[model samples]
Target chain A: MDSSSLLSRVRVVLCRPSHPGNIGAAARAMKTMGLSRLVLVAPRRFPDAEAAARASGAVDVLERAVVVETLAEALAGTVVSVAFTTRSRTYVQPFRTPEESAREVLQALQAAPDTQAALVFGNETNGLANEEVWQCAFPATIPANPEYSSLNLAAAVQVACYVLARTCEAFSPQAGAIADAPDFVPVSHEAVEGLIAQWLAVLERLDFYDPAAPKRLEARLRRLLARTRLERAELDILRGMLKAVARKIP
Target chain B: MDSSSLLSRVRVVLCRPSHPGNIGAAARAMKTMGLSRLVLVAPRRFPDAEAAARASGAVDVLERAVVVETLAEALAGTVVSVAFTTRSRTYVQPFRTPEESAREVLQALQAAPDTQAALVFGNETNGLANEEVWQCAFPATIPANPEYSSLNLAAAVQVACYVLARTCEAFSPQAGAIADAPDFVPVSHEAVEGLIAQWLAVLERLDFYDPAAPKRLEARLRRLLARTRLERAELDILRGMLKAVARKIP
Candidate 1:
């Protein structure tokens, strides 16, 4: 399952969110992580300017969001749902980290392509009640400060979406490879040997290399050259510098 | 070093942030992850009511935040800093994912307890300039959607802090263990055997078990019993149910 498809199977469900700005912020957060589905359950306000302003570029997510009257309706087709909560419950529910929950969700999506998963978040003030949490098969929590673990609703969504994106392999740092350096071709072994020979010749011309007392200099130079996974452009620069130095040696 | 102290040594630096609400949201994000120190580099507006309101319970982080005129000034004491950027730069800087960057930062903090590290975020509009990014030792980019990768300023901060908190083991889902279940004692071997015996006795009284045609039922029951790592309370419930059934069988 590719990352985006895996993420597509997952949805973010906000239950009884009071602040319209948080709804917008949550939309922006979800979109940034490549998650487009948003389900708002009984929100206090919708179609508000504050949410649109906060959503910034992700107002499309809000525009396409599904507003439901009940949490069950929001999670209608999900094969598995994770309740995002911090409150300690009386029931014996196993809680997993966001990373763990994401992995599980992705695994389920991969195992059964048609299955959907949901990440459910509660209101800003009071989190999901016990009855609401019971609807979810998995309960996940973010570890925060003991003194103050009050994570803003949108901030919590951002964290969960980030984890899901990372776990699904949707985005990676290597994805940001230098786009401008299109000509960064790796030099061959023979090319590296040629560059080393030229460097030694330059050093000999400059009186920097001595036949009488080489003193492991050639071997050390070879090790250094091998250590660097030189690109063709870099090899060219080094060879050019050596030629320039040799020409000026006289 | 402990997770809190390790997190305390790291600070968040927002360079040229334009929105006061973002500053407050960033502060809230940091506090939720057990981070306290915040440094702002030439924000467009500060000491604004919008920032305070957005900060929510994290106003203390904002109040104690250090405001500096220059990015260099903000990063004075940091041994290493990660420039968070999504821009395609002309320079050959390596971009790491947030998780990898967090591991690197935590490794540095653990190696030298007194040394400090910083996660630097760019402006809401243009992000960090190339010159500003060159000032940092490492550059990080969040793996976001290629089509719509504009993560909100505070949302980015939340993701970074959440990763850092997870890397430092500051908060974990296991920390939300059921606090009310104080008497969750593991059942003794003798108690489990006793319960099994009682259950079999009840089944025999009800004629569900036959001496001549056991049909591997006893072994199957034993296997089922071993599969469950029963608690004392669970064993008690089972034993009580078996006793009631046995009394009714007569």
Candidate 2:
């Protein structure tokens, strides 16, 4: 689940940026969120003095940034193109809250494991064109104040990248501990429900309770079962015992 | 849960900043992420022209920034103070995931709803002193590539502010939509366990199943409860049913 490798697959694409300074700031923003890939689609200025100056110490991000002639060129090999749109759009496009969008991004990485994804941002003043928004499979919107929802392009990138980084499964001391610990992930609800039905059959064969007066017994059992937080392997073991007991009966 | 109001209550405190440019960049970084309150503690240089140049158009954020003599003064009126550190520490300060720290910061805001909180970042070169870190209740470390993890002061601010902004409840279109949406929070696991123990007591008397051959039954039951993800009211309803069943058995 460690996502640093997955994070490497995420490209922060700034489309047709007007200000060199915003480009620089966006580079710094990307690095902070552990996102290094910066693909610029026809930015008005690149390799500009203003950009280098504004990049602060994250000049490396700018230096390594990929500048392409067109948005299509920028998203060449990318699978999921997510647009970071500011204004409300009449255009039809799949949308998700930034948090949920981050999850989707992670899942994309999880699904392919090696394939890449792109997060596209439109120009500062104009935002995304309807055509550009439609090009994306997913569009993520940041929840800012409606009255003054003026988030700078770099800031929008910062928020999205930040959520992606924060949501990432880091292989740090904390994540390492969680992985090493025996707190195995619990089994699904469907699996547990199936196990419960099987157990009921075994109980009926054993004459444990009169089936006619089972009043609240099954519900009580369900509630008790719900509390254990059982792992998949533990569920398997329990199911095995149920099968064994059922086989013993006539 | 648009947290713009809650964000304003956050004080981004920098202790002993050596460079004025970093202060400016940090201000810009904060503003991008919707965090404006800045407190400089014993900075080596303040109100310098270099800081203004670096701040870009976010000088308004810097113009309104606060400067104090000590970290204590910077943290004035702040009940929950978090220190951001880079190096691994053997010290006993409580550590939290940035996500968790943001939650704690939000809770502090909720506890008072009007009072301010602080996220304290260390100096550019040397980071916070041991004594300074101990002053804060929680400490959070960003998971970065250890090989070249020399994140600039402004970049650190950018990451932290981005996380805070992303996790906030903004009054924007998407935020309103999320707030209006019903996503019920489940009851705590401990509360579920206590109810199960009470039910087990009655089950013993009712001669439910073979007590001698528990046979992973209790384990299976616990798993089922965990899967239910029961709400408090549902737990209450089930507990009432358990009591009724116990009475009938006797």
DockQ of each: 0.19, 0.11
Q: Which model scores highest in lDDT? A: 1
Q: Alpha carbon lDDT of residue A22, candidate 1?
A: 95
Over B1-250, each residue of candidate 2 has an lDDT whose tens digit, in order, gives 3467778888899999999988987887777667789999998989999999877767888899998987767765665677888645543323566767787667656555456778999987789975566556456776655444555677678767766765565543435312221333244434556776875665555555466777655654554453344554557756764564454442
- Model 2 chain B, poorest ten-residue lDDT window? B176-185
In order, the Cα lDDT scores of the candidates are 0.78, 0.71
Name the regions of candidate 2 deviating beyond 4 angstroms: A19-25, A48-63, A88-90, A171-173, A176-250, B1-5, B19-21, B28-35, B48-60, B165-168, B172-250
lDDT of 2: 0.71
Expressed as tens digits, the lDDT of each residue in B116-183 for candidate 1 is 99999999999999889999988998888878899899889988998888887876666555553354
Indicate the TM-score of model 2.
0.62
A161-190 per-residue lDDT for model 2 (tens digits): 767776675435364322211445567999
Q: A147-214 in candidate 1: lDDT tens per residue? A: 88888999899899988887766777433211122333444445666787887775555455676787
Model 1 regions lying over 4 Å from their true place:
A173-250, B173-250
True contacts kept of 1: 0.55
Q: Report fnat in order of the candidates.
A: 0.55, 0.17
Report the backbone clash tally of model 1: 0
